[model samples]
Target: MSTPHTRRSFIGHAAAGFSTLALPRWGQAQPATEPAPRPAQIEHAVTAPVAIEVNARPIPAFEPRDRSRTRFGSLQYRSGLVLTSPHRGFGGLSGIRVDAKGERFLALSDQGSWFTGSIRYSGRAMVGLDDVEAAPMLNAEGRPITEKRLWYDTESLARDGNLVYVGLERVNQIMRFDFSKGGTRARGEVLPTPPAVRKLPYNKGLEALVFVPKGQPLAGTLIAFSERGLDANENLIAFLIGGPSPGQFSVRRTEKFDISDAVLLASGELLILERKFSWFTGIDIRIRSIPLKSIAPGALVDGPVLFNADLGHEVDNMEGIDAHVTAEGETVLTMISDDNFSLLQRTLLLQFTLVE
Candidate 1:
């Protein structure tokens, strides 16, 4: 562990060493000018899977001002990385799924692209990445999903064995892919969803997904959560699809946070990763642990906040979360950020140990 003085000294030296680097400050004020027209969305249509080089810079401490204090809420800081890639299509990572062994990872950008890679670890601390590849998400006809209008914005991801489910926010639809067929090359078919799902508010719909595996409380269920789709009672609307009790439920929304991603733990806990942006405070991210058994048709579920962080911490647009148990029986939570392809934002990958 790094001490505050040492960390500060190292950072000062690093700043001096890299003073010429043009990285944008997170919340610096911009010069006022006439608003520019929004540019057309960049399409990351890859003909096939292609390897990409990504650079990872180690973040020695989560809270730079107090490096020695590792414990925060119900988690203990482990390691983190500030990830960057020269590839133009490399950001906007909305969701991620890590293998059980905490090695291989599958991630997707909101621009309808797949990023597959493995985490290189040195004694449980992430060193960097290896074997990273980028590919466009394909549709039923083997064409890039982004080739269609309003078919991108792939925000949430869930995995059950070789089967993968992705939730697209722009169209409020779910697409299924079988990795066994061709890995990221597998074409996605639109999964049938309830009529209400298509009625969710565009851009705010279908932000988080968790697939309950066999032997779980809601086994064989695809749990979907909207970013801010609210019910008449003002709670966030969620759905249980293809489960024994397939219906709609509500997640009690508080603190102005919206759902970004979620992971269902083997311990019967549903951890929802949420974030909220404010001009006054920048951005804030949090994790709430709700019991899996408490969710059912028409049930209103709520949980205790397990963690929270703000811009004062080394955070950006924190968007994705996943967990894997280490050999020592420690549940390690991994988080990734979506830069929104903006110079002022960054893509951060952070990890923590869930201290039960």
Candidate 2:
């Protein structure tokens, strides 16, 4: 019934409005400093996964490929819907934010480190040009552009308010922008890796941010988490830290929590997704839970609720996680996979109901 738009078709319209899709006028150099290495090799320590016996349910297995809608970097869920799309500059899709009206807004983070523009979803998952574009300096092209690399392994959006946060993995900083009034402006900032955190071995960089509910034991404190370790192959549980501000973070070497795609729950608990790779190829996706208060630098992580997928079933790079309350007042957890645009990857969006 519908035909997919090709690169030619996508760019043809841009060529008409030549002034729109312009490159960033200026390019900023990344911070020039080598990250400090961890003191010693982290012993391959697997903390006992804490049991998260939720009402277990499974979603269809996702097979990612290196096509259009395959490379997923980060994602979010607003009003119980998942937003999955491309992240940076390729005329592709950026991230998505579901609004209060149950409408999905396409967000572009071409601000380099600042905030950019947004697009509104029209039918199904596709959006119209009029959806976004009037915003200030949103994209590098000065027009509506997708496929942007805001940061590596990170992207963010907020619901119930005009708050937006983006993680700059390279510099390990989180830029906070307020949409409450309008126009994206940096209201505050936080550096994920403090001087001490930079000392961790293979601290490639920090890249995940999940806000803990205020009033909870861990409320008001932002959790600056990361997907750091030896190599991309070897498995490493992400680390979590409580920070009231960027430079000032709660650092305790002893408390380490392991969870894949670290996400915080509505109840102030942290949901950990474990990606089990098959001996040969495929990956098994599982879910585990932990209380926000249980996260300390030295606190050992034990017990994890296992969300089911096929064992050894591989997809693309699975990153980004967000939880929302469904219209029925039920809690739902959704996930998206990063295609990486690699011949070996595909964009996958998986959803599940949390049974605890």
Candidate 3:
């Protein structure tokens, strides 16, 4: 084993207008944002697809806590695997989403690549990935986002019907893609997020996005959260956009955990994926649930920790999450990690049965 490196995360630059979103380095006032009438249409062209491929290897053991395969909290480990590709643009996958059937998956990298693939199963356990394809996240001009700008660090994703919303962390902006027409080839139009969102610290802003389904309590509401965006009082901030209610709320920060990703359950409960890093502990990840009915303006939302794991287990910088239902009516939670395109880190895909 390699010696665990001891280091703390450093602050990054803010968005276009703000000096800082949470922690002020220069101390400046934040500008307010005027909400647009709705999502503006993006005029994007179809670009030639980039050639990409992936290789998957099997990991036989599902349980990482121990040899017993005992359940931990409400989640049971299903399987996990590391993914690699010869394509140089691969890795840094910070956001992910899956179809209702759990078969198809889409993940976006901070490096501006889109990874699409399907899950392959052997019996009931996940065995590998299939039909994997990687493409650049195109800009409004139909060129790769990285080719367009340096700040296009795609980090979080939320989907409702044919509309998909992707969060760019370093730039502190949200881009909406209308897939009802061209699918992944759809042009991306910027969404009018709150001025506070624009103030979030670069590389930590807008880490999680979840859209409540029509039947949910907060139906049609779009929820966006920061990785560690703190208020003057040091409360973690979250925004409720669109829907019947639109406002800001707080989520209590504990154990140095920051939001990595989140998914909404059929029961209207929000499952948040949080992570922590330390020289002593290396890395730690957890899942916490907050009731949708509890999230309101200025509400301090907190919930029981459903699951937790550390570096002793098979984990890296796990950052993306999505949920799907099985034919047996079971809910399966899927997660992915951002390798940071580093040899020291790995791109991992893990799954577990959510037995709430």
> What is the C-alpha lDDT profile of model 1 across 131-152, one tens digit per residue?
9998888899877888788888
What TM-score number comes out for model 2?
0.53
Q: CA RMSD for every model?
A: 9.2, 15.6, 10.0
Give the per-residue lDDT of model 2 (tens digit) for 85-160.
Answer: 2323222122333332323332433233222333233332322222223122223223211224433323333332
Query: Between prediction 1 and prediction 2, which has the larger lDDT?
Result: 1
Query: TM-score rank, highest first?
Result: 1, 3, 2
The lDDT per prediction is 0.85, 0.39, 0.76
Off by over 4 Å in 1: 1-45
Each candidate structure's TM-score, on Cα atoms with residue i matched to residue i, is: 0.87, 0.53, 0.85
Evaluated with TM-score, which candidate comes out highest?
A: 1
Clashes of each: 0, 46, 1
Task: Report how far residue 262 has shifted in candidate 2, in Å.
Answer: 2.4
After TM-score superposition, the amount by which residue 252's alpha carbon in candidate 2 deviates from its true location, in angstroms, is 14
Which portions of model 2 show Cα errors greater than 4 Å? 1-160, 181-193, 200-203, 229-260, 276-279, 310-315
Residue-level lDDT of model 3, residues 38-140, one tens digit each, is: 2222122124334466766654444433556747689887877778888766777888898888888888887666778888887767777777766666678
